[model samples]
Target: MKKSLNELKELAKICRGDIIKMTTVAKSGHPGGSMSSIDMYLSVFNLANIDPKNPYDYKRDRVVISHGHTSPGVYSALSRLGFLNPDEVIAGFRHSGSIFEGHITRGIPGIEWTTGNLGQGLSAGVGMALASKITGNNYHVFVLHSDGEAPKGQIAEARRTAKKENLNNLTVLVDYNDIQISGRARDVLYVDLFKEYESAGWNIIEVDGHDFEQLFNAIEEAKNYKLGPTVIIAKTIIGKGVSFMENRHEYHGAPLNDVEADKALKELGVENDIEKYKEMRKTLPLLRKKLEFDDYVITADAGTPITYTKEDKVDNRGAFGNAIADLAKINKGKIVAVDCDLKPSVKLGKFEKVSPETYVQIGIQEHNAATIAGAMSVCGVIPFFADFGVFGLDETFNQQRLNDINHTNLKTAVTHCGIDIGEDGKTHHEINYIGIVRSFFDTKLIVPADPNQTDRAVRYAASTLGNVVIAMGRSKIPVILDENGNPYFGETYEFEYGKMDILRKGEKLTILTHGSVAYKAVKVADKLKKEGINISVINVSAPLEFDASRISEYIDNSHIIIYEDHNKYNGLMVEFSKSVVENRLSPLSVENLGIDNYSPSGNNENLFKIFGLDEDSLYEKIKEKINK
Candidate 1:
């Protein structure tokens, strides 16, 4: 039920009081911005097509709190509107024992995308808005941001994309309070926000943020506007309610003291019952039940796996393209392919042809693409962000990290990984992908050995939940063959994550390898076996995790060589060494035969030989180790 203008005005005052009390009790929060943004929050939440009872509905309107530091205002407005308990939000506001974190979290009631890192929220909102168009859902997306984060490049990228897509269901309510951590937002960054939005083709509406009626009307106009996305630049005063705190930059992030809070609450005409909540804060549990996000279980039909044989010489990127395009055909609009101006190189042209509506091309905007894909993943879309590994993983690491924090189900199919892209040189070679991906706790990395394995890995990543990176090289690789000259990752092979595949059996020394060099390891093992020096060759597709039992027999008290086209310091060698010690498997000697430093532009074979990772070089290294 929508509240009357008079009723909303009264509620805002109470919410203002709640904001002051909560932040003062917590002693750390951005109360000033919260106070400034409170009236707008109250209006939007009331006007939006959202229900406190059915907040988890996929079709519900998404309200992304981009400036998540204003949680006091968000929680207070939500509590007053029946989305949360007032007392819990006040007492548990930034306590280690409570879910009410300093930054707004997504699992909380009424929260959509959890955004604290400035500049990415708009991109996330754009993704959610695009999902509605692709799925034919009428739900709208609203992102509440601030002028303080206006100068960020990702925000500009998001604005252009929104306008380019003509997202009529998306609205951004920017809190133009003009104050930030240091001082005035204009003095800090000097971004002409209105001109920026105008140039980007957004429908702009300037309004008084403190006026409930004006905010409600602006939102109503945005909801009905059909040309493109709308941006309501709300002019507001920092610490709006209290006269002493008004326009003061010091109050931007720092909370008021207890005495000041009491005074502020008294001015707002709300009761000062802070003593009771302060006591309640102490009694809250250190650990509450974690919020479960199992609402979006993937139901798309992952089509039949395509197997490549010895006759088919293809790059892993080609295999990825075939698998993802097949998935798009089978799932239709449910599988979205996001490209960062690398559709041709990343092999997403087929996917675009099959599902044009779902293929989002965010040209040269990897940061925005990464966050946008992450947001779309939660909004009933299986988004696959395809790009070169350097751009997708290296340049957009921070965005990907934020995606991981949001626990988003994003599948990133990155090609041109490692030096296999060769002549592209050091800048293009993503030698640290394994290290970068390993840093994300919830993300899994799959480095497929050959074209056949790449196809299976892509499908597996699409079907799974959480973040997964399917890293592959640009060069075409031969199909890995078994003893009978048959494709090892053949027709019947079901890709089980974390399981090691032993391509060749031996006894002298064990060689562990993945992706760019897995086939080389097998060749070396076969050649050594021919010379009466048997050694085991294992393919570790999922480098981040593995089942110790699968490879324990080969490494127990035996010499081990970790060979790969990755940085030796933090690649598979580091992970394998930890497993050996943790699983109590004692290896006689472990050597790392991987890229120790960057190589110059040249053929991948020459680069491999230089880095001691080519077939012959690996064979010679194993021989030397065995001789010792």
Candidate 2:
């Protein structure tokens, strides 16, 4: 039976009460947007074909809360729907150890995508809808936005793409509360969302966000129409239920004190009903279980195991493509791989050969490729995007950052990193890829030293959690470890994040490098041994958050020379220099050798020599610097 308008209003009131109590207890949260969007959230979740019990159900509709600052509202709805206990949900809001973080996280089961940053959810939702259409799945994607977030260009980009593609299964709900943190949204930035979205070819609907009946009717109407995507602009007050706080900008992110919580609960008619709420919390797990069983009926089994012979020598990018192709053999429909017109370059040709239906050639559109990957990740299909490091990081840095913000489990394989791309000239050489990617806190940058590590890293990244960027070099080096011959022992090489590997130990100077430069440093160290200079070489693959203790131990014993195939300003050299100074390790003279300025077009060897990165140049520079 469909819930009545009054009942939905009552649920929204209950949700607002919970939002106040939870944020107050946590002592921090966005209450204004939470209260304002409570009715819209209640209306959508109540009517959507989502199985709270089976949060991971394949066929269930997906909801992505783009305006993640309003996590209080999302948490409230999840709590009422039986996905979380009221107390646990309340306790975890902004708490250190709790999964109920300040923003929505993957730790919460029913939350489709973790989000905090605005303007990212719409792109992710578009990807999900696209994946469902491509895979022949009957699932709809719903994304909630803030009127204040309209200023971000990605949102407009996503809207245009959805319209062009005619993604009718996608629905976007804008919480037009007309207020940002500072003041009125109009004062901050005036955006006519209705006209903008309509002009972009979206079917637009405007309604009172607090009116549950009107919201439900619009959603139903959108579901019935199948021509293009729909945007439901929900006009609402900043803080709805709490009279003292309603429509106030100050309450946007302020936490209520004890007296305020009491007053808010009193207004909601649930002042002394803690016990009743606890009882309601106890029924949620069961409700979720029932919902899961009903909605997530279609199960895609793990497909056949892939067998590869050890005779073939494949590039890491090629190996990644091959592995994905193998995964497609089993679960063909559920997996989709997108490339930015660099399929042949990234070796996605293997996957394209086997499962052409699952491979999307986005045609050199790096931004579109990233947005598509974000969308595909949310739809439950593991999407791996491949492109050159310069294009992936330098070109689409914002898109990837948004992917991280949305917490989409998107796997990005960036190849042709560093000067190893060699003959392609300085334009194709990308040495600062690691530093740029490492800047994002939520992203994991995996630089595989060899093909075996690359294969393992790619496989693990595909199966693992959260957003990951796997970097691969252009040069084909030796296989450091044999995974096929000794799979168990090979796994022990241990890919613990932020850890460095000691390649060679010497007493004179520490040569810290990563990617292709590390291999060059190893060769240089071997040659320098003949000249009686024992230099230690460390392959610092995990550059973002390196194990300081391990690095300090190496630095304590020897003078440091950090070599990278990137610029010296913000690359590995700068980070190493900063780490040494910050940790106050043993006083050691540090010299950085890398591309000093903008590189000019030249052959790889000539460029390396010109940049003082060649083995001979490095040997002479180190010998001269060390002797002094």
Candidate 3:
């Protein structure tokens, strides 16, 4: 139910006081921007289809605040609207033990997405809007952002996407306060907010942000809009309501002093309850419980895992594409494919063909694509973002990091990893994927050893929850085989995450590898076997995680070598060293051969040979080490 105009005005005034007290009590936060956006926040949550009683209603319209620095304003608005206790937020605003964090978090009763990185909220909003399209839901997505963060290229990219997808159910409210952390937003960087979004074909509306009636009317119009997405350029004053703090950039991030707070309280006619909150703040603990994210259970048929024979010359990327297409067929409404214009290169062509409606082609916007896929993953649909490794991982690491924090169930199949995309040179090579994924606490990295493994891994990620990055190479290699020459990673084989697969066991030495080099490790093992030398070849597919107990047996009391088309210092070597030290496993000798430096343009075979990662190089190195 919409609050009466008179009630909203009274609440807005109180909310202004709430914002000031919360930030001042916290003694650190973006108070000026919070005051500027308080009225907008009040109007939206009050008028939108949200029930504080049933806050987790999946049908409730999502409210995403992009400029998370103004978290004080958001908490104030939410509390005043009865979603939370207004006094608790006022006292515990930035206190570490409080749910009211320094930045706006998602698990809060009314908040939808956690956003502080300027340009990502709109993309997330777009993702939620796209969710409505596929699921036959009519709920709208409202993204409240700041004009200071308007110049971000990702917003422009998302703007184009909103128009391209014809998302009429989306509305963006840009808090156009001229002042920013530097000075005026224009002086820092001129982003013609209306023109940029208008150029992208979004319907534009200019409004006095503090006016509840106008804000409500524009939002209502936006909801009823059928042409495309709408953007409300809300003209607001920095540090609004309080007379002294108006239009000042100094308070953009700072709270008011005691003297200033006293004077401000007098001007607003609101009680200065600082002493009461101070007592409460003193008693609060420093550590808060971890925030819980929305549970997103993805249900999908993994289709059937395919087994590539020794005669089948196929790249892991091709196998991934086939699996995605197959999953699309079996899981009709439950799956979506997010692509970044590298459909052919990333081998998403087959998936696109099989499920055109489920395939979302966001052109050349990796950051936006990452966030979009992350948001969509949580909102009923399982989104697979298929892209090249350089663009997917190296280019958009921060976006993926946010996805990790959001605990999104995103399956990112990144092809063209390592020097395997050899002719493209060092720029295209994603040698540090293991290092990148290692930084994440939740995301899993599976460097599938061959097409057969890739097929099963892709299906595994699709059926599972949480973030998964299936890293693959560009080159087509032969399928791996067992001692009897039967196909390894066969149809009967299930892709058990964190469990290492031992294909050929030997006692002379142990070779650890994954992705494109597992088959090469077998070649090295086979070569030594021909010379009557025994060794073990193990496939460590899930680099970020592995069954340490299983790997302890292979590396214990034996010479070990780690061969890969990855960075030597940060890849499996790091994980192996950690596990070995922790488990007290003893290795007679340890050798790691990987890309120490970027290789020049050449074929993958030549690049491998140049870097001493080729089968012959590994065979020779192991032979010398065993003799020693």
Candidate 4:
């Protein structure tokens, strides 16, 4: 039997109580926003055609929480719906080893995407909706957003894209709960979200977020609409249930103590809350069944491999494109490539020729491309997005950050990384791609040394189950390993996260580098060897989380010279120094050879020489430092 409005409201109240109690016990979480959005959450979970028993089922509708700070509310609703055990929800908030983190995680069963970075969920939702349309699936994607976060530029960009594309399967719900972390949202950034969305070609609906019937009706209406996306502005009060906490900024992220918890429970007519919680646990299994776990597999038809000749020296970007085409031959149905109008330069045009239907030519919209990739990932497809490293990383860092938070498993192939992208000037050069991506723990940064490694990295990224940022260079590098050679080939060197590959062994100086700069280091080491200076060269591919223990033995035996195609401040220089210090490796004297300052417009040779990143410059630097 369908649940009545009163029953839904009662359930929403129960959820609010659970949220407050959980956050109070954890002593840290956003309570106000959670409380305000309880009714809206209850309405959707109750009315949407979502199956908890088959959470990953392809036919199931998707719900993306944009206002991720209100994780308490989402956890409460998911718990009440039986997606997780009530005890797990109560015991796991901000706890170590608990999947129920302060923010949403992909570990949670029913969550379509992990989110916390604001203003990104809508874009991701658009992608999911687009995927549904492309694949002929009849599922709707609903994105819940906070009012204050709507003013971000990406939000506008996403809205414009949705409108232009006529995405009717997408719906955006704005929790117009006046208050944010500081004060009223309007006071901080006045936004007529209803009018803004309407002007952008979205069908706007305003409703009392606390009203279950109204919210349910709006959702039903949205599903029936066939023109464009819908935006439901849900006007709600911050901290709706608790009298003292209502409409207050202080309660946004504070945990109530025992005494306050008692008072809050008393207001809800649940004087003996322990008994109530015990009884609710019995009904938790019903909610768990709604989270489905059916995995759908799509196979691609076989196609001829576009083999490259030995004489043709191509850039990593070109090799990545060819690799994508190879992937399309293997998994055509579930693999797609998106490019930001730089398809010709990024070499994604090759994939487009092979799989025209699977390639999306999103012109000059890196932000849109990322969200599209996120959406496609959610729909059981692998998306490789390509662009220049500077535009792809720095310009759309927030989009990728949110993708990581969402755990979208989107693979980004960023070309022209670091000062090696010469003559384009400093504005076009990307020397900080690794550092920026490394800052986020969820993202894996892969800097392949050569074309073969680039192919391997692309294939690995396509099959991996998390968000990835593959940094590639514009220049063509010589193949370091022979095609028949097996350098650590059989011994499980399969792109383990945080593991480094030792290319050459020597007892003198240790040359640590990655990407394009690592090649220069190898040349420099060979030059030094001719003059009786045998330097060990290590290709440290995984930048974010390096294996200190595996490389600790080598650090003590040699003086380390870290070379990179990036700035010295927060790039590889600092990372190497910190690693040595933390491991307490005999206080080794390390010399950093990298682009220490802004670069100028010049050829690749001039730029590398000026920054001391080329073989000649690096050789001189190492010689001078060692001689002294």
Candidate 5:
């Protein structure tokens, strides 16, 4: 139900008071921007088709606050509109124990996206808008950003994507307060926001942000515009309701002192209740009860797994392409693949051919594409972001981190990882992916050893929930074969995540490897066995997880060989050593055969030999260890 203009005016005053009280009580927050953005937040929350009781309703509109430092404004607006309790918000703002942190968080009622880092929210909105078209949910996405973030290149990238996708279901409300922490926005970095939006083919509207009638009318106009996404440039005053702090850059990030807050409250005719909230905050629990939001339900049908034989001579990327194409055919609208103009290289061309409508081509914009894929995953669509490891994991690392923070069900398939990428050199080789993903608590990483394993991993990732990364290299390696000369990851082999695949069992020593190096390890073991040195070889696809029990049986005098095409400091070798110590296993002299430094661009085979990771080098190293 839309509130009347007079009713909205009265509510805005209360919300303004709430914003002031919360910030003043917290003593650490951006009050100026919050005050400036409060009225617009109130107007949108009241007018949007959102139910406070059923805040996570699938049919409801999504609201993203890009400038999350203005959390006081968002919490106040949501509280005033019945989405949260005003008392809790005022008492818990910026409190360590509360869900109401300094920045806005998702899974909180009425907060669609957790956006403290600026300029990414628009891309998130574009993703949701694109998901609306894919899932036919038809829910509109409204992103409220600030003028301080107008100069970001990701915003420009998002604008182009929105226009290219013709996302008429998206609208952006920019709080053009023209004030940043340093000084005036124009002086900080002049960005002609209106002209930029106009150039991006967006319908533009200028309105007074504090005026209820003008804001309401502009929003209605934007909702009705059919050409493309709309941007409402709302002119706002910093410190809107308080005269003492109005238009002062000092108040942008600094909360007013107690005396100044009291004077400002008196000026706005709002009671100064900071002391009461301050006392209540001290009694607040360190950890609040978990807030309930709708859980992500996987709806896509993971098609039958594909098996590749030794004669297939296909790369892991090719197997991924086939698996995703198969998934797209079965899942149809439920699955989408996001590509960063590397369709041919990343092997998403097959997926594009199978389901062209579901394949998104975001040309050369990995940052924007990464964020879009993450946001799309949560909006009832299983999005797989396919790109080279350098772009997908290394270049867009922060975006991937944000996706992890959002707990998105994004399957990131990064091909051409490690030195197997060959001539692309150090710049293209992604050797630190294991370390990068280890930082995330919820995200899972899978390094498939062969085409057969890659196929199963892709299928497994599709059927699974949460964020999963299936990393592969750029070589046509042979399929991993069992002792009986059949495919190791064959028809009957299910892809159990975090389980090590012991390809060859022996007693002299154990060889642990994954990805492009797994087949080489098995061959090395065979050669050593021929020379009267029987050694076990294990492929650890999930390097992030350390299960000491899986390898306890193969610990031959604690003499293990850790060889991989990854950085020695953060790869499986480090993981194995940590697990060994943590699990209280007997210490043994281990030979770490991993990349110690970057190599020159050449054939992958030659590169391996240069780095002393080839089959012969590994065989000799193992023999020397056994002889010792």
Candidate 6:
């Protein structure tokens, strides 16, 4: 059943035709790169240890295409290898109702990680390779990337990690075709791939990618490499087969027309079948097979949710570190934390000390770390990617966005969120975590008010499935107190997703806040209580998912004041406003209070005062508005 050299060469020709036919029918896609990388695909699919029949085999090799725009090539090669139907792919490439999306998507039988954004695929492959080491599996991970994406900083980060971990099970095939969407890849951006890979301590294998023998031999040798990861820097043409298209940048993304397709098909000795696929595209099912996701979920022994008493003052991140450490201690391989050199800042010091192996220290590589954590999280490990909110969310937004699309079970915990991370200036202060996480439909955002809630939330996230972002501030704060001065999120409180904790109840107005500001809201409510200015304080831990129905009574009569340390135009205020209109609930008056502009570098207290986010500011603002 294995493909011989002659058979592979012939199959390669047919696959080239398939790629062209599919792209021509769709009137879009990267046929040039696909054609360039086709031999590598066939080589991996044929010579590699993978079963098309049992595509998701546990020990089967993972094929990750980093430059996913070459999806036409991937689909065609997989179809030839029996992973997908040839005709379906030809008609459905980038179709509105097809699984053959513009970029390669996971859950499509042969695809491992869904990738479109460059520089992430190598990290994803490194993650799978790391998992193999951790789980003691012999499976190898193969990532096919383009030379154009070699300049991505995250790829450099991934290279360092692959070397540091000594991941011999990982092999990368770079389609060094030298041409990109622009002119020559070197002209657009010069990346010395050989030097870089060698510097990263990678075993570099140079080969003519079009030669089946060289490709297969290189891949086999890469598998036999004992030192560390191998990079098969396949020197190739931009368009390998078609004479006119070869090394041409215009053909990179543009699909050939009918006349050009006819000429190309004739050159490859394949039939001009564009019209056939175009007709088939009309009758193809409105919806293809629904994506089969990785059903692996981590069930941690979510030990007793620790309750911080009113007397104990702690930062939410410190509590998170404690709780995550407890989880890592109890559950060995079931839980892991991916750190980007911010162990002390993110308070992952405890987890690292308790379970060192469980702590993945990929330094200063937030994009790669985010992606790697996402990959590992899907592979039966609950990976908590901890970092500053700015680095964790803002810098690595696209990586997280892909993770959302993949629907990975990742816990992205960020400290130094909002103006609370003062003196670091606007750059370090991540004031829009709520806004960023709101974009992720699958990811739930939790801004825990205090140490107790942080502990409970971390525990909850560990037990639960799907993506979650636990956003917190840097500064330490008092434990949020109930009406009787007892801890609000205390012994009896089970951290629920959408439910809000009413710290104190008042008749005149309600102040909605979370994270470091929740305890401050409690103080404001308590202050107002003495002067007969009874104001309610509600701690909205989960800003993304709020059951307005549960708090309808609080907002119906009381003037609602939204307070936080986030962008006023794009944070909890906007979410709450949308919720009010959607739920058709009426509050006396709605006012949004938060950072509308960037504050200067100083202590958080001064920053808060400058932004009018201090306890006194909220108290006075409430009095002035409600009294009117």
**Residue 269's C-alpha lDDT in candidate 4?**
60
Per-residue error for 474 in candidate 3, Å, reads: 0.7
lDDT of 1 by residue, 330-360 (tens): 8878999999888889998898889888889
TM-score of 3: 0.98
Clashing pairs in 1: none
List, residue by residue over 1-628, the lDDT tens digit for candidate 4.
3467888877787887888777876778988999998888877776766766756768888888888888889888887876778777875566653567788765476677777877777878878887887677878888899998988877887898888778888888889998888899899888988778977889999999988888989999988898999999999999888899899988888877778888887887654354454343344332232223343433233233233334558677877888888888677556788888898889987798888877877677788678778668767677788889988889888878777755566888899988787888899888888679877877888887766567777877777777788998899876554223443322233555567877767775777888876766776776787888876788887766665567886788567787888777777776776777788775256777778788998898888888777787778777876776
Evaluation by TM-score, superior candidate among 2 and 6: 6
Q: Point to the candidate with the largest lDDT.
A: 1
lDDT of 6 by residue, 188-247 (tens): 989999999999999999999999999989989999999999999999988789999998
TM-score of candidate 6 to 2 decimals: 0.97
Alpha carbon lDDT at 329, candidate 4? 69
What is the C-alpha lDDT profile of model 2 across 1-628, one tens digit per residue?
Answer: 3467787777787888888877777678999999998887887787777766666777778888889889999989878876677777765566654567788875466676667867777877878788888767778889899999998877887887788678899999999999999999999999999889988999999999988879999999988778999999999999887799988999999988877878888987875444444343444432121112121212233233233334445566665666677767767666678877787888888888888877876665577678778768766577878889888887888788777765667788889887667677667777777678866878888876666556666666666677788888776564432213432214356456677777767776888887666667877777787887777888777677665466676788567887887777777765675676688777367788887776766666777898889989988878886787
Task: Give the residue spans of candidate 6 off by over 4 A.
Answer: 285-289
> Which 10 successive residues of model 4 have the least lDDT summed?
286-295
| Alpha-carbon RMSD to native, per candidate | 1.1, 6.8, 1.2, 5.3, 1.2, 1.6
Over 4 Å off in model 5, which ranges?
Answer: 296-299
lDDT, residue 244, candidate 2: 92
**Cα-based lDDT at residue 536, candidate 4:** 76
TM-scores, each model vs. reference = 0.99, 0.74, 0.98, 0.82, 0.98, 0.97
Candidate 1, after superposition: displacement of residue 89 in Å? Answer: 0.6
